[model samples]
Target chain A: MSTTKKAHTTPPYELIYWPTIPGRGEFIRLVFEATGTPYTDIANETKDGISAVLALKDETATTSGDGNPPAFAPPALKIPGQGKDGKALVIYQTPSILAYLGNKLNFAGTDEAEKHYILSHTLTALDLNNETHDTHHPIASQLYYEDQKPEALRKATDFRESRLPKFFGFFERVLKGNEEGGGKFLVGGKLSYADTTLWHVLDGLKFAFPKELAAREKEFPALFGSFYGSVKEVSGLKEYLASDRRLQYSQGVFRYYPELDRQ
Target chain B: MSTTKKAHTTPPYELIYWPTIPGRGEFIRLVFEATGTPYTDIANETKDGISAVLALKDETATTSGDGNPPAFAPPALKIPGQGKDGKALVIYQTPSILAYLGNKLNFAGTDEAEKHYILSHTLTALDLNNETHDTHHPIASQLYYEDQKPEALRKATDFRESRLPKFFGFFERVLKGNEEGGGKFLVGGKLSYADTTLWHVLDGLKFAFPKELAAREKEFPALFGSFYGSVKEVSGLKEYLASDRRLQYSQGVFRYYPELDRQ
Candidate 1:
């Protein structure tokens, strides 16, 4: 295991994730891309993707004197100058990572309450994401979609009819209730990470549950506009989505399991 | 609604959660307890507990200009301060609240990465908590555990045999591979909210899946030891637990559905 050289200039920290899966990692990547940060996507190729992912899971690598197995799995970020011996600090968990990045890019918010507001919205977006994943893998992530097809059907029925509407309604309420921002973004007037995350979540849900999301989106025009509307107007985000940087969904958190969707 | 008085001393923030349920609120409550901070727990039996919770969650109140709804749920911390109109700042979301307290108390770690390390571990704890909930209500939270009893049984089988061990094992590795404090705590040498959280997670699993957790604890003795050991030694925790502040797990995230636990 040759050590990767840390960029003297910080060089936007290295991101190690599965190349094929656009699951939670996309949240981090989207932030980097949206901010035009220079980040190296080390595992965006199949040849070494699995190995890179497995290395974290490997006992030898994990048990080595590294910092607590990179704080629990991917989408781990390796900051250049933070750990002992200058070893990169690798932290996982999508919402935490998003919050950290939000703090870094000054999108988290100003006060303690607003920061908590951003976090609350972030957690809500994640709750929606988890429900979307459960729609397909309701039984267990250990089992394939085929193995849990029946369970997925029952789960998706509930998710589409209940959870989807509930979460979408919450987001809609957040937008509509945003007296601070005139019903624009998830938080205050600015475009925080929660807004970006909500956009991705909406995109993922729409891709996975087209009919249901489309029907629900009408009530959340501001939310839809935030993503498909004003967000598209951002040059960096527009450029990133059009470029190779924006990885498509293949094996990520929100996969397109057709059997789980409404006809 | 009558306005309440705010504390001037800013002693640790007051955490109001269900006394018996280790639900969403325990994360914040535990951090406060572990840190030996001066705080209050308005658990289930408090004279105004139910009404206080109800008023916070009231749709009318949510739309009103009251302190941002405490992250829209419980496990909220009423940081003693004045809002725009001399109101207290209510911070919500279990992870967000924990992170806020961790930063305030100095357990969140020394840098951006460490703060994130704590954040990731907290999120993982939440994921584990969610899985425990799902084992009983595998399909959806909207459906009662009784309604999904059949699926819950099957899911708990997987949870006990595979998921619990896998997640517990991961934490064991995390504790053992801790380079900073020689694997003593989750991150650094001192105890973190993550460690406190891990203690509660394992304890809840034990209560819910005693037979399974008992058998598995032997393999991960250090993890179990650190959890039970570290928490027991925390200054205020034992008193808090005995004094009715420590919630019993009845209505929280990791509820014990007996049918799911049975073979």
Candidate 2:
């Protein structure tokens, strides 16, 4: 209930993730940036702050402290004064973090029904992100892409031919289906975190599979045209995109490998 | 607000998913069964019920009627008279459906913080389920496992050696950390959907990688011992597991290929 704290309020939010490469942390960041809300990117902004993230993934630790369980991975959020007895609340999973902040910042939706729809769409978009990551590391996340090159090549081919069209068509239908949203949004008329999250994934796709995305752009006009392009112009996003804070895509969830792309 | 309806209500929830396998749909079914709540499994119960599922994923249609967007896949839940203007509310995505049912069935948690944690844990369990599936079809979901057998063996090796322990250790720590849960629940003192969702994943893992799981079971006592053994005895789960309603795992996310298992 302490999350009643509005967007611009005190108790600065802390995002715990890897220091760079825009990884899964970027999904959490886009929601914050798109709402113009101030948050501390703990691992990126503060030196030695990544210790907080390391502790989150600490294998020996039983709990995350302040009555929270240890995170299975990074991209966790810590909100001060929001836990039991008014301690800090820590939550992980990119969609879960987005849901918590989206509701607080009014990017969730108009009502409970809209809220779940937005979360569902955000989750679907994240599924695409994970599949994209698998294209480069099909064999094992612990193994480098070079070691898994043969398998990665096969996975990337299926991803470009079948998976990409399936996901793109679904989102395109969602956009066209929502009368209020027209072609610019996935849920309701306004820019919910679903739109923000999907936009970032699309941007990452362009970066990771430029040739494939370029070839398929005209197929899903709603997704690649209006919904994809106009999202960058959304209120707080325009400035963030032009700023240094919008980290470039490298070897995170998305990576650009020429051989992995359309030949 | 419509979800204010509690368990054992008159709504008679309808679950839309493919019949014959405990796929992602089983996550939704567990919360319903765990609470002794009644729900109709559309594709399984009725003779011509697949029409509803087909309509949900109609690729040509932009909207899924009754003001709902088309689902990206099966395993969608429909709550009649729960949407805008009192229409059937349809939602997809395993975790999203589980959260909705868990809350309605009183299996979510006691407070807002617990609710998010439970959902986050459920997502992690589902992530493990997904990785298990990828091991068999390392190259493409559309491709036959035999065609990808070489890659499957390699991926399965990494999964058994690395990923399984990481997930098992994390959940073990979670069970031990929550003093109130005492290795019986993942969140608070009560049985939650997170517990049910995780219990199923562990069950599937045992089926998929029996040799590997047996080898590693002793390493994480909290998980393989108390937590795994006790959840089956949860109020409604015991009866549900005994009944014919519970489908056997076949060619779903968790598949048993001796060649893919630890040898």
Candidate 3:
């Protein structure tokens, strides 16, 4: 064995989320993946990663950042110090993380109005994501989907028949009205965080409600097909999607329950 | 009738929402009330206000801001011209609106870390709010609460027993860990938008789940009594709460469905 040791480059972002499911971490992951930012996924990289994630919620965990506020939930990011003496920043809340990353990555927006526009879209996408999660866990996240099957059935019905079309229609209108961005992306002509966020939304919705989405495919051809096609073709995102890193949707947000599915 | 006409000061902000119920508008209203900012509550002021609100969603409404993107939903704010030749700005999404007002009102945060901390709190509060809304309208917002009473019962149980405590507990931890702010407010010693937002969350929870919240009152004494008490004592908010402008909780976000309440 060689005595010489190779120098290691610290991954700027340290993502801590449940290793099993993609969940909300996927949103932050997509940003990193699309930008090709090297980051350590704490949970995915080590056996003790899940424990590290859970320890974040513990009030007295013996973690490195002891003084920082404990994240209410996981999918928290530990960012490296910006300056030589700056302290590491641990931030959570999916949209907040995305906004921070967007700012760092320069995909936020060029102008004030554009930034707010992107923020509005990102929040709306999150609203849809929340509703999608509720479709499966309508009663509570603490309870199993099996226990709330009846409630889930009713909630999913509304989600599919009414909420799905309404949300998809809104994005379609956004795409059609993209005069400033030439109708290619949600914000400016170039891809912004909103585009990636929306891409994930559409992808998750399709995974969760294939039959229902297929039934209404023609309604938002520009959004579901053209816009999605363009986003999927982004060189970085394309490679990420094809890689094993893109976890399959299981019991996470946008879960598929046969009983809840409708055409 | 008096012949003399009084000079009118244009309200700097125009808030448009369904007038009969507080709904999400109350969040924005609390910010305005706490700051004593003069604003026009459109739907409450005029019979044609709903028409104005609807026109915003109409693609062919021939509105002044024709090229600007329409709001995805109600509770949209219309900001008057800032400069002599500036055009009005229309923006919506409850948290988005709060952020805009927070920046304009200087209640967001003093520094970058503080701003992101405030943002995390605001988003978490909004998450709780969304879940609260779904407790009643788990099936669909478009459908009547009566139609989803069975589903609502199950969801309300989960919300009361699980979600409520979890969210409140998170806020309590945030309050306890505030060494920098002296534990008086969510962000800093002085009030921020997160403080106002949390006040609404507590108020709405008490209104909707009185028995449950009361039973757990002692658990979050600091949050329920001190933080909430302080926020309520803000002069403008105290007056607003007592005034007729403070709309009652009806079939809105925090409706009191007797059947759904439990200890």
Supply DockQ values for each candidate.
0.51, 0.85, 0.39
Candidate 1 lDDT, tens digit per residue, A1-263? 11223223334566777776677788787777666666767787436666667676664344422443544566777676566677766767888777877777677767666677888888888888888888777887888888888888999899888777666666666776666766556666677777778788888887887777777778767677654577655656787777776777766667777677778
Q: A1-263 in candidate 2: lDDT tens per residue?
A: 11323444756899998997788998888888877778889888898998998898789998898989889998899999998889999999998898888878888989878888998999999999999999999999988989999989999999999999999999999998998987998888888989988998999999999999999999999999999989998867888888888888887888999999999
Segments of candidate 2 deviating more than 4 angstroms: A1-10, B1-10
Ranking by DockQ: 2, 1, 3
The TM-scores of all predictions, comma-separated, are 0.90, 0.97, 0.91
Provide the overall lDDT of each model, using Cα atoms, as 2-decimal numbers.
Answer: 0.70, 0.88, 0.78
Query: Which candidate should be chosen as best, given lDDT against the real structure?
Result: 2
Please give the lDDT score at residue A127 for candidate 2. 95
The ten-residue window of minimal lDDT in model 3 chain B covers B1-10
lDDT of model 1, residue B200: 81
TM-score, chain A only, candidate 2, equals: 0.96
Which ranges of candidate 1 are over 4 A from the true structure?
A: A1-10, A45-50, A60-68, A226-228, B1-12, B16-20, B43-46, B59-70, B82-86, B179-184, B257-259
DockQ of 1: 0.51
RMSD (Å) per prediction? 4.4, 3.0, 4.7
Instruction: Enumerate residue pairs that collide in model 2.
Output: none
Residue pairs of candidate 1 with colliding backbone atoms: A23-A252, A23-A253, B19-B247, B20-B248, B23-B252, B23-B253, B83-B87
